[model samples]
Target: MGDVFAAVPGAVVDETGLQHLGNPLAEQRRLAAGTALAPRADRAVIAVPGEDRLTWLDSLSSQALARLQPGVGTELLILDPQGHVEHAASVLDDGETTWLIADRADVEGLYDWLRKMRFRLRVDPRIADEFAVIGGTAGALAGVAPASPAGLPLVWTDPWPDVSPGGWAYAPVDPHPGADRDWSEAIVTRDEEARIADAAARGDLQLAGLAAVDALRVAAWRPRWSADVDERALPHELDWLRTAVHLDKGCYRGQETIAKVHNLGHPPRRLVALQLDGSGSVLPDHGAAVRVGDDEVGAVTSAALHYEEGPIALAIVRRSTPIDAALTVETADGPVAAAQEVVVPPDAGRTANVPRIPRLGRRQASQ
Candidate 1:
């Protein structure tokens, strides 16, 4: 069944485990209209059973999950000791168990970590290889089931638009881009994947690839663990406080850093949207240098060509960078001028409704 779709025109399987079906731009359109799906081979699922599943996870991660009701969708981040994002997962519970869908590269480590942390708890964690992940918009998956033949298909609906309980929004816009990112991922069986592949073979399934999905993600200013995060990534820089981090949550691995920064400091860097020159078709590669004149102020985290908006990218720039600065991204051939759109503004800090204590500078001025 896989071979049948592998032979689809321009079907190239990359290391990311997503097969691009030739026209990514066209795929983007189909995806937006809720007619396309991306078989996400790059994802893996973990199952946690026992009555203590929800509270056990709530005690460890960055989200406030003490009350994550069944069929509800949310996300949590496993932060390093320093509050840096180490692993991220989309979470869902179906009354009996909790499902965690994370990137394949990080899932194994996450599984191991969860096992080690299960001492004296009722949590039993294991890799759910029987399941495959399906990525598409909410409307496209309107009728999708939460369970499949393989097992319980925990559906992780993205909860980015709303300021989840105990979460904060750093995006100051009235209607944030996240409001339109109806992205979702479903856990299904091998048989289901085959069924979709067979449909594609018969010209029935309009499928897209990582390229199309990622481009829209960039356009939506959404942060991805694989592309946007490094060893030093903090949730504040990506404006991820909107969904992933629960500032008031109980102590976890990186909670200290999260508190100190949001209360008294700024993230050393910030996320910016880059509009690459569309004069040529070549898109800048990941890790491309984002420069101000000859000095590299930041590096491109993700780059893609959108369907309606052409040649857009996301880069993490220095917090002190001028908002109106005209920047350039280094491509293989040459440099392309990039205009910076502030995703995380220079002053993005302490977004919660915590009461304010005037800083020393303000007191001194009044004195």
Candidate 2:
């Protein structure tokens, strides 16, 4: 693949191994305006080939896939036995192969799991390291002529900022960030990366770093595997059902827990958007305690300075935390007051419409 940082001055690589241009704020604005594109170096692609591929994956993931349409964008999650998200992927198929855009951190594990699960199925899952992902506003690259070492490229448009089929929206507020989200990623051969980067470097095309992309993601209330998730995190808590889940899909490993939670239970915690008091220069890191008064109620999952929202963050707080609670995030600079905005409301589930049992007193009176 292309090393975008090696050829560009003032480019920095992030913790996730992606090249980021130094000017994040400017980049964020440019991208939202469709004037810039981000190289998704924090991600990798895997290709699943064979006639059995679609059906096989459908049997194992949260999204139904046996009849998936080509070029239609969707996503999948592999949940643990407890229905906690274990892995997630943006999925697209190009007639012959199912392309999976996975978090760089989850690639190996997802590959291993697929390989082990392919007992006798004629499917092959292999890394598409030859392809590098470029993300930007919808249709930004639509006019880019194809010149690739791996034939025609594939594209996966994010369905986030919108509720996909069989998914639910917990963000009750109107005019949510996702309402205008236009993120899309296209995969081109590694050779194309340098050309794209060079063009971006020359200002022939605009360039954005990962920081800008992340800020936009946070503003949209999107949940990502590497940054926003923990061992106990559930899809409902992150409000990820907007894109990464299928409630009525066929049984998978964690189906029981998923069904129970959505049908009769609520997530133990819920996601909130935090507008930080940016008086101090410090930005809270992931895992920074989020407190209501002196009591810890949650922790910051992602934090960034939005080009529009100034300082904003995403935190998973106790479900019982009052929706209007004034919270603070514990930062190295002591504490920064955070105003909460609901992403996943405390009453996120109960969709199964499981019948509520009558209280003992009520039942006795009725009897």
Clashing pairs in 1: 83-254
Give the alpha carbon lDDT tens digit for every residue of 1-367 in model 2: 3466456656787566544677899999988988887888889999999999999999899888999888889999988899998889999888888999999999999999999999999899998887788888876767444223234357788898687888877776666767788988987766677788777667687778888999999988889999988889899999888887788888889989888888888989999988888677688999999998999999999998887677888999999999767788988889887877778777777553223222111111111
Candidate 1: list runs displaced more than 4 Å: 1-4, 7-10, 143-153, 351-367
Cα lDDT for residue 340, candidate 2 = 77
Across residues 111-221, which tens digit of lDDT does each residue of candidate 1 receive? 999999998888899999888888898877664454543344567888876778787766655455557788999887777777877777788767788788888888888
Q: Give the candidate number with the greatest lDDT.
A: 2
Report lDDT (Cα) of residue 257, candidate 2.
88
lDDT of 1 at 299: 94
Candidate 1 is scored at a TM of 0.91
C-alpha RMSD of candidate 2: 7.8
